[model samples]
Target: MKKPSTDVLYQEESTYVDMLLRKSWSMRIAETVAFVLGMMILAQFFPSNDTTFKVLAFAIAIAVVGLAPFLYKATMRPVYKLTKTHLIVSISGKETSYPLSEVEQVYEGRHFYRLGGKKESLMVSRQFLSHLNERLFYYHKGNKRR
Candidate 1:
């Protein structure tokens, strides 16, 4: 009934999966230390006297530790722009736009909201909660008359 606003209201690029996996900086340090230590300890069971075996194990451990974040980040589905009229969902690199007027269900969460339409759903940051609620409320209210 109304023209969709083009101005971006609240935009966040972080993904729902990332929010779940992201740890505090200090916690990350601890985990990394633990992994390295665990790998080195496991290396102890090799039953070999040569120091090269221990060095090889250390190298493998470091490689695994370094590559882990990159591996996880590659699969993160990013939630793109949140505008007054549209929410963009991005998986890989493709973007899909969902109209706010079509929103049918809102699954609110602690840090994110799962906005569901008739055929699809997308996760968004809590920063858009107020705007989403106001818009969804009015959208549903208007639909009730028909």
Candidate 2:
């Protein structure tokens, strides 16, 4: 298939996010689950004759809960954009554009497209799945690789 140039990919307007709609609410809920599990695990050690283990677990759980929000804030969310010829991913503002010709497969995950081979895969949300199918169908059909 034909490859798109870097210039065209970088200049494209389409940007999509893999993040769920609830945003922070969803993330916090997941983190809260971890906090509950950690507390349960700590509870197992509470009855132990060894006091140090209990104290350590308690301290660790508290520390994790306290730092959870800050850690989530510090984490970098990758940005994805689809151009006429390339799949672009940006993390911490650094953009890397991959030619759409390299997309060997389109359907993998439910909410995201696993764009790349086993060595390293970029996850772009399925928001562009329909357009991507439209763009790449000709290439795949031309070569009978679909």
Candidate 3:
């Protein structure tokens, strides 16, 4: 489908998950502090003379630190902009547009509203769309099932 040039009727600044993702730096620092404290506790259980235990603990710590950034990226949610005819999502500085006609379903979940399509789905937190919730709710009401 061709991209729509319409202005956004509603926009979500950031979802709860996205807020968490944006705090990755703080999370990583906390993780590192916890890892150090955990290692200190584990050190008492394993004797200093045990080379194998020391090597294993060191390896695991390294792996955890190395994978932290990737885990943060995986948890990020895209920014969402909803227009009359399309939904635009921006992830990692890239924008993708999907026609609203392709949206198969809209449902309110416990923490977020889910918009599902044939190949893609978006989870929109209520907190992020607090200002435009009423408008979005009414607009998608017809698309929702009983």
Candidate 4:
């Protein structure tokens, strides 16, 4: 088989926050079930007045939907990008170039890349990566030795 092109390999952005926030296959199902059950429970407690029931149900419905996006963002995975000119990190928009004699390593972690150096390190996530290539990433970072 032909070697996978570096350009193709690094096209997608995988944010830690995104992944974490995604309702798990099971969680989505559970949420649906809970919504139904909660509605039923609340309905039983509803005032005999139809208006009161409608208002309470509407409020609960709105609150659940409103919180979904925030919950997803909080739990979702972070993001990063690897391009030829520079390694663009998502969280902070930091980009580091390759070929620099100083950068000691590049490795994947749970939600970010660890770029090691004698003095400090650079960490990037999916949010930082943009459309680019590995060569461009190296060139942008000053073409330092890998």
Output the number of the lDDT-best candidate.
3
Instruction: Give the CA lDDT, 0 to 100, for residue 33 in model 1.
Output: 78
Off by over 4 Å in 4: 1-31, 47-49, 78-146
- Scanning candidate 2 in windows of ten residues, the lowest lDDT window is 9-18
What are the runs in model 3 whose C-alpha is more than 4 Å off?
Answer: 15-77, 106-123, 127-146
Residues 52-98 of candidate 3 have per-residue lDDT tens digits of: 66886787687666655446456554577877666677867688776
Q: Encode model 1's per-residue lDDT on 91-133: one tens digit a residue.
A: 5778767777555443454333434434333344455555566
- What does candidate 4's lDDT look like per residue over 1-146, in tens digits? 23322442243444334543433344356456666776898879876468978887777776665554455435543244453333433432333343223233333333223343423222233333322323435555666434
For the record, the alpha-carbon RMSD of candidate 3 to the native fold, in angstroms, is: 8.9
For each candidate in the order shown, give its overall lDDT on alpha carbons: 0.56, 0.54, 0.58, 0.44
Instruction: Return the candidate ranking by TM-score, descending.
Output: 2, 1, 3, 4
Report clash pairs, candidate 2: none
Report how far residue 66 has shifted in candidate 1, in Å.
13
TM-score of each prediction: 0.45, 0.46, 0.43, 0.36
Choose the strongest candidate by TM-score.
2
Candidate 2 structure, TM-score to reference: 0.46
Q: Against the correct fold, how does model 3 do in TM-score?
A: 0.43
